[model samples]
Target chain A: MRPAAPMSIKPQADAVQLVLAALIAFALALPFATLKPNRIVPGQPLFLLDGPPFWARALVILALIALATVTWLGCRPSLRIVVTATALMAVILALGSTAGHLPPSNAYARLSPAAGFWLLTGALGLGIADGFARLKPSPLAGLMAVLAAVLILAGLFSSGWLSGISILREYQGRSDVFWREAVQHVWLAIGSLAAAIIIGIPFGLLCHRRPRLKAVALNGLNIVQTIPSIALFGILIGPMAWIGSHVPGASALGIAGIGAAPAFVALLLYSLLPMVANTLSGLAAVPRDLIEAARGMGMTDRQRLWKVEVPLALPVLLAAVRIVLVQNIGLATVAALIGGGGFGVFVFQGLGQNAADLILLGALPTVGLAFVAAVIMDALIAWSAPRKGRGSIA
Target chain B: MTFASRAIPRLIGLCLLLGLFLQPQLFEPVFRPLANTSAPSIYAQAELWSLALSHVVLALGATLGALILAVSAAVVVTRSWGASFLPLSRSIANIGQTFPPVAVLALAVPALGFGDRPTFVALLIYGLLPIFETTLTGLTTLPAPVMEAARGSGMTEWQCLRTVELPLALPLIVAGFRLSLVIGLSTAAIGSTVAARTLGEVIIAGLQSNNLAFIVQGGLAVAGLAVLAHDALTALEIWARRRTRLAV
Candidate 1:
């Protein structure tokens, strides 16, 4: 079998990957210009023959074509296309607006060079970083990244049918609304996640030390998790009100079940299981002999925990945190249902109003928040890991 | 014989006691409206059974589908140069896990309409990653020497995988399924909002009406179902582990 020829396929893979990158660039830029001002009037689309003023539309279409071409042709550094597409769209919009032919309604209709661009860029960067993770550029890694990107795009396309397209167009003018809501939504997600991590980590370590306390703590979390979040909020409402009524100090806390407080509490409860369970698991994974060795070295329990156990356990603990963060990023939107206020308001509102653009506006940020957090967490874990030649003590 | 075993029963007894003791007070508000003492309980309706049955059917179907796809992907990626797909698989799986099942529902509702189909599709996507990740992890963790020994015994790749890798990986795979099933149980509640008539509907209804008893009833029903499903899966795990050892 000739020793399998040492498996050299990186160059071939990289070349193909470059083409795919170019194509993706082209794809993003395509709709911006070519999408012509298609206004549907319930039954038929009111197609303006003038159509977004030829020059403006031309610039948009040209940028889109460039993006699609880049996406089609790009290779290993596929995220390059996303950046290229965003830059192209921005330039096109800027240049078109200055020419005085930019349609008033479509002028604010910026080709969202934000969500899709950032997501694709992050994916490409992470995939490449991880590709070299095994100390060699693994072709298998590149392929997987490409396949995932394709799948996400496929899901987007499949979700975007004919009516879906028209619905999205309706919110072209509501860009301001979408942008404001998206920003606040992202902030809420980050704030809640930070609170969960800060509180959960210490709680996890406390439960881990006692051993006897582990079951009760873990089961309590499981029960908390099992309680439908909405019910938990409802359960809290009566007590929050009761306290607000009688307690002078509590009234000042602005303890309302319909806003940020209830949502924050519900999200924190959701964060417990993964955080606590993984913390315990990580602690358990520390080699027993290492603990003995640390003790032999005359290190205190706290010293051993901080210097030895935690460093080793960091990766697993981070994984748990990542799971919780991603989950909360998505679930927090449901908090909008109780008038707690977040991006979910747009999503549920869009649903009620039968407006696809509003739903996309809400959901896009959620996906964006989850994506950004997952990537950052992953990068942090990779960076903190012990380097080569470090003592394994395995 | 051990305190662990004894503790288990105590835990169960405590939960039961809490439920029973709280039931009267909890039911007071719900029953107060039907004070005539003539109305039948809502739990007795045929609708409740249908909802429960539909939920079970969806869960079982999604679970089975996930198992097939995840295991196959795991086996291929773990055993060969097909590992090129690993990053993609991992990322896609993560997306499935992270992609709000609610978002999936909202997006899906437009295409599939208000029903069980969209719910099942969303659940299936959400279900695959944990199982796939665990399967791959377990297979990679298998002792290399054992695999080599099996290969040296003139076994084909397929037979070696079948008789060795899979058996060794069973425990971890079971652990993965446990996680997936629990997540599915919670998420399955969202199906009710989209018109599937699941236990979530009861809970949401109770919430809308501000009825504590209904909330408790809905909450308890879903929680009970989750615990029961988890325990059943645990039993299956035990049985599978025994069977594998028996084969060895």
Candidate 2:
């Protein structure tokens, strides 16, 4: 053995590690809270050092150290994921406990986490998920990790571990109203989607049959989509109010200028473009050979449409449903401006009150709803895909 | 026949642009029936042209920002070294879409302290996903043979991307840009709520006072912009496709 062949090692730097390091550095340096006496009052800067207990602080430091160590060692992918996940959990617990323990200096005084805290938490959470994703390409794993974290967080919240947080206080005060608004929000979204499908599918089929109609219908819906949510809401009010007052039975059935009526109509109109366009596209995508074969088998136009076209089109159509549902859930937040009760009520109230926590209280749930809708729709599309097309469709 | 086919959409687009400028005079007669009602006439209150110009500017700015960010992101993810970042980039784009623009405004206001900044942020976020996704689709779905041929000719990665791939993908990318621009136009209207100068101010005021004319003015201006922009972009896409076909 001639003096052991010289070994050459190439130093490698992971971009992910570099990003995590920068994020940790930023979190350490920035002020974690803008301390305030109450929701309405302006907050003064409160650094991390001025807040969180020593152990909580230590946990944050430890997490950051662990992340750095993993980066330095260039650990195995699985080990990196586990370390990142643990660090994330530690950061979450530390932040939560810190927020929960912020002493209520007075009955009115409230301590709220500021921009830095939000940025740090979001970065840590995202980093951990990205790490998990790097370990395995599946989105489901990252999603499961997120679900686990959320469950743990929720458990903490419910068990009174996080009761002292300002946002929780906001929730505690309006828990009933929050639930009511959430229900109302979901109801409005579902109602508009149902209405859109009922009206849109027939219109789409009509457009599909008549090439001339397709252009006009599509252009009209596109124009409708171009109208801003607020403008659409505003436009609906005059006509709706006029109809409500002049039409005898309209008011009795809740068709008013304001409240849910205009909101529902606007949302329905918004949903139409996606529903109709998708229907048209999905139908168009059905293979010409398949349709011809169906016809050759003595299938009538109706049978071909029902049995062949729709079955083939189901995936795309379901995709459209997902898009419309998610879009409506988001758009419905603006409905609150017109007395259409929903999460927007909390949003506007928060805006008016100058309370960031209240806004988060409202906004987070809306995001949650949209996420749920997306996931469900994705699952539905996956389930509905033809067995032969599963590999191709995704 | 080709000229005629192309001319029709151009004509429609030009007509819409002309109509947008002439809306006050043209719509005055049409809105006369409502003038007698409690709501004020649309042209009576403010300069529709200025509001329309502001709306266009906001949308254009947001679209430019979104296009730059999205195209760069798309390009990065398609590269060999950055390929692993694709899912991450996609999720980031999805998150941008997942948060409502209104919520973005609310959250941004706290950090940026309300005005055009938050509005810009919201519009940029809202517009990003469409362009990014479409660009990705355009880049990723290039004909394998064409790509192989380009590489077979000893073209550098950047050169291939710049000369062949980009040209091929231009139409679809432009389509995505058009979608983002239209969305930005619509969404920028909500910027009014955050103290951003937009046509939405007209609409919001209308909502507050129950003024149909104001709503019509704002809505018409925004919608007209959208339709005209859409037509122009569609024409561009068609032209790009034709050019690519001719090149091939």
Worst 10 residues of 2 chain A by lDDT: A4-13
User: For model 1 chain A, where is the 10-residue window of minimal lDDT?
Assistant: A40-49
How high is the DockQ of candidate 1? 0.31
**RMSD in angstroms between candidate 2 and the native structure over all alpha carbons:** 3.6
For B51-91, candidate 1 gives per-residue lDDT tens digits of 66676677667777877888888988776666766655665
Interface RMSD of each: 3.9, 1.8
Highest lDDT, which number?
Answer: 2
TM-score of 1: 0.71
Q: What TM-score between 0 and 1 does chain B of candidate 1 receive? A: 0.79
Interface RMSD of 1: 3.9
Which runs in model 1 stand beyond 4 Å of their true positions?
A1-195, A227-247, A285-313, A388-394, B1-46, B76-83, B242-248
